[model samples]
Target: MLFLDDSKAAHLFFNRLMESLPDHVYFKDREGRFLCVNRAHALYLGLRSPSEAVGRTDYDFFEPAQAKQKDADEREILRSGVGFIEKEERANSIKGVERWVMTTKLPLFGDDGEMIGTFGISRNISEMKQAREALNAHHRLLSTLIDILPCRIVVKDREGRIKLTNRTYRTALGLAEEDSVLGRKLSELSSDGRTQRYAEDDRAVLEQGASILNREDYDASPLGDKRWLLLSKVPLRDASGRVEGVVGMAADITAQKESEARAVEAQRALEEKNRQIESELQIARELQTELMASSMQSVQAELAAGSPFLPRLAFHYEPSAHLAGDFFQFVPVSQKSFALVMCDVMGHGVKAALVTTLVRGLVANIRVDDTSPAQTLHALNERLCALLDRPPLPRFVTAVHALFDTEAGVVRMASAGHPWPLLEREGEGAAPVSELECGPALGLIRGAVYRDIEFSVARGDRLLVFTDGWTEEADDDGEEFGIQRLAEALRRCRAENPYTTLDDLATALRGHAPGRTLADDVCAVLAAF
Candidate 1:
């Protein structure tokens, strides 16, 4: 028999050593009964002491099938008389939570050289298994992100062979699944010089260990169309600081480039139109200056000798545009009788200016025997209708014709779609004069009836004739300089001379309007008796 004393001491020492181990340790007999258990094993099994587990079979603490498997493993270890290792195995805790473990079983022998039991140790591998699962999940997520990205992505190895490409990259190149482009270089796919250049650029970035971004004006598409793209290339490096590959992303900018092109064309067209309008306005200004000079000369020559009965007429005329369509005329019918007429054509600029010139010529040649205001208007209407008979001709003029008989102090007036004239008596307030509106706008209808209306004019009385331009002008705020404002402005300046009164009225009208540019031409004639 073996010496029981030293054997018992050796067993106690081995058990004490196993009790200090970090992992769980136990010994099972060939019958699968727990012969001994260490502190770690008791703690793992939720036993108060090793004595509670001694002499108990694995089936006493574990399920029957699991206990049978353990019993078989222990018998195998004892029979083999060698150590065996299980890299990974499932274990159940006392609370029934499953865990992964790395386990080792060593056969134990008695002094007689016969296997008695198996010594087993187990290490928890649950954390390592979980880490591997997490890494696999992360890789799957990264692959999904690459496939779903809107931009084209590509990865190339140091040899310029394509290692990976995203969905957009394949779509952009019109690649087929059987093409096997993953290991092919860009030059193999596209032999064009432009593709070669892009590969060279990517290689340079990899060599320099630098990134390129937003390199514009680079051809990116394989198609012959002139398309643009924004390209970015980043060098991928290994742990040793060596360039391994390049990751590139390209975004198509064809639409943005087309928009820029269209904007340039629009800008050119707008500039050309502005130049044409400016040229037309300059020519119109020169013609208006010449017309004003000639009209003033004619007026001075006609009034060379002071007339006995003609009123002393001084006037002021201002145009908001290059050319004005407001016309004024004074014709002497007799030694003591004169007719004063004012007309405003429909609009401003060259067209309206030409219409005013026609009115001037008609009034200058009108016969003095025409004593009726209605008759003069009838003759003027026929002349305008004949002149404006062509296609796209302007066909409207608002007019007031007055026959002033100085000897009788009578003013016979007639209007055709014109603003009413203001009359200011010497000691009375200003009011609109009564006149007959007997006709439509001139050139609108031929043979329209016009009637003359008579009003008496005495000394220190005034008759003011004006165009709708004065009362219908718009400000920046879109409000009109209405008739009420015009009347108020005229009444305020009634005491001034004909020229001074009209000047003050025009100035006030301009000041009241917020915008610097006038919306229409303004014209006014002040006749003081």
Candidate 2:
């Protein structure tokens, strides 16, 4: 090696070693100025040489706003003299290209143990993130949302003890709200024929991955009450496909069962009152609207006021002539989380609207805080399929369920034969993030499974969740306003104020249709988080 001064030799020795490493190495002074950089760091920052990056700050190599956070992180390390073991961060290069990096920073001290600067190493993990994204796209698992569902959902372990239960199940069993009556086996609920039957079905599910669909049974409660239950049970499997537990869902049909026995005698009276039923239907429609509007008023008001829990909210719903088969609502999962629910029952008119009514009632009751979107949709599917089978109507329902965590800035979404949502980020420079998967419509096939995908949503990001009516509405020329136009419209509005997002979409959608009246029901919600 060439001869040099002690300090210069020390610098040279460290530089040579660090430069040989593939990861970026950097040194920052207490004031956040770059003291030294390795070859990898220089290349990453687009510097001609390590010397060229000396004394420069991250602002010189990144956007000023982005640099502020990095500066804060380094300053905090210097002030606290504590090391950041490993922090994975998302960032953009000087060229404004986005990537992921795993960074480690430690306090640099002199021989006397006096803190001098910060020594950091950052490894580009963009390739790893890309591979993970691809894998998530193909093989996504929607875990259990069974806990927060409004229905009487129960999960039994291999030993037949209850592993989990939803609120509805506890209430139905006459348990107190604060009671955690877990490990209660099916046989413990009652010593009747129904419990014996359920035990056999649970065994079948665990042994053979069997699925029992819409099996009606009488629940003889220990409280000395009898109720009709439409129960469905399915096997739970591990990654290796080994059956581990069995999940059971129940729908109460006590009222319907009671009404059926009176239907025959009331048929003659109903025949005489057929002409007056139209007025009654109108009253029912008005009542439904009033109920929905009342239920959603508080949340809508809070979101409009720019509450911390709900940054922004906008919605538009248009029901086609003859009936209202479209329904959408917001359910609060907790103090800081909420769910946007959108559903459309197929084949318009009284029957379809009635189905929507049923769907809305179930949604209003479900607690989404402890559930996954996939689990929520599965519970809905099981209930709707069983309920609709009573008359076997010529219709199905499509829906999208999304849970938003305000504090953490995360979104979990699942769809039931619904269209994928459109996303618009904060700034114009940010491109729209869209596309995932849409599962089958509910009530179509027995025991159909749906999956969920999760993504990070920023504070100012806007999500457009709509029904097919919004995208499939045809113009006078018979051309539908497709996804491309919708995306372009969302992009165009990204530069505008967040408050203008819903109006922009509504106007754009209406203009595309070229008529005062829509041919189909349309339900849309624009949520800014």
Candidate 3:
């Protein structure tokens, strides 16, 4: 009905079909001039009507380069009698707008089968092209991101076929750039035992849909070099939450494993060394106890036998560690007098115990005629200063020396950076004897002079000498049991026996300490006059 037998009706139908199409339809003569054009083609050339572009060519409407390419292509189609089908090309319009179009060009034939001109149709494909280009760019960016990472990464399908891999993964398998690994199974790439094991693991993950995290394994490189690796594999799921693949990551942990092994060995050796030192310290502790007890007991016995007035000396020694830094020695200097020396070296343990040993040796060389407390400390300081002169940091000792003359009823005491003694008279309260002057700690300055303070003591009076540990014990609140508290505790003791009095004072100190345990070495001596 559209092409009823009349030539006018056929012409009208052809024009309507051409104008209704969204694509540009055009025809050109042998000379490359537009013979006819549809409405869409006319509008693309910036023409008001189809007739307006009848005598024009692409050169009048497009850039020189595009026009030239179009002319060359149409001429080739005309000569070869072959059509260019669905070829994508860039089109630049007169309005300076660029578009990508898929075009089909055909050589037109007349009724006599002779080539007359070229006819073409072009469809816009700019949006589709742009979308495809953006997708390719994203793929490149993702590939670069994974390739730059140091960890080996791999992605595989549920069938155990490799879908993606990073550069490190390829290099670890000694794969060259030209090698194609995608879509290949692990066994196909390498038939080694480890590769087979990896295939099994992939199957297990796919079946169970579980994640295997940080599994340490011993492995070998392509070159047979041993290595340690921490590997993790997790099931990659789809939008519907079904496991479809696996993402695997592996990190080289050989260095860390080796370091841990070395640390374990070092710890074992250190524990053994500690046990050996502990055994030696036990022996030294026994020897120290025997030597100190024998020296003190002999002096006490000698004084009791020689002097008309018998004096009582009682002491309590408690070492916080296996060995103590606190030491005391009693020397009988005359028929009616004795010298008592007490010392506390800086810290407790082997070093302090060694210093105490050296002090004991120096005390043994003291002459029996020298009863001056200050002179004895001066002599000890000079020897210690010479002996401990070389050190990164110097060691020090606090000391108190006293000469007790029972017949004269006097105690002459001198201190070298030690705590002041506490004095308690019969029927009077106890207090620190702070009036006694103090000198620098021993092992500091050579020839450091010490001065003695003479205090009278009658019958039924008592004097107490102690280390800082007794006054520096702290409770849970970090408050120290200071010298005042110590004096208060001493005043509360009403026992007549000197030993009982010392025990009561120690109990008070233990009660004030955290966990009822002392944190430092403590030494205390009570002299009952």
Best by lDDT: 3
Per-residue lDDT over 1-529 for candidate 2, one digit per residue giving the tens place of the 0 to 100 score: 2122368778687757877989988887788888888888788888778888877888888877779989888888887888896688877877877778999999988677899888899899999989988887654332235445656887888999887777677777777542456787867765555577668889888888879999887754434478887889999888998888998888888888889868966987788687578678777767756655554565555443333436566566566754678777777666567777788888766877878778888876676667898889988888878777765574689998888777677888899998878777767433333365678898877788888888887767778887888778889888998887887887777634544765787689889866557778777777766
My TM-score estimates for the predictions, one after another, are 0.55, 0.44, 0.83
Q: Report lDDT (CA) for all predictions.
A: 0.75, 0.76, 0.84
In model 3, what is the error at residue 343, expressed in angstroms? 2.0
Off by over 4 Å in 3: 1-55, 84-134, 178-180, 194-196, 220-225, 238-241, 285-291, 306-309, 320-323, 365-371, 386-395, 445-447, 495-500, 516-519
Residues 149-257 of candidate 1: C-alpha lDDT, one tens digit per residue: 9788889999888988888788777785524779998778775668867778887988898899887755667554476888889998889988999998888887888
Residue 391 lDDT in model 3? 70
Model 3: lDDT of residue 500: 96
**lDDT per residue (tens digit) for residues 200-310 in model 3:** 778889999988899998874433458888989999999999999999998888999999999999999999998998898888887767776776787787674645345
Model 1 regions lying over 4 Å from their true place = 1-138, 155-164, 173-192, 195-211, 222-226, 234-246, 266-508, 511-515, 518-529
- Write down the worst ten-residue block by lDDT for model 3: 1-10
Ranking by TM-score: 3, 1, 2
Q: Give the clashing residue pairs of candidate 3, or none.
A: none
Clashing pairs in 1: none
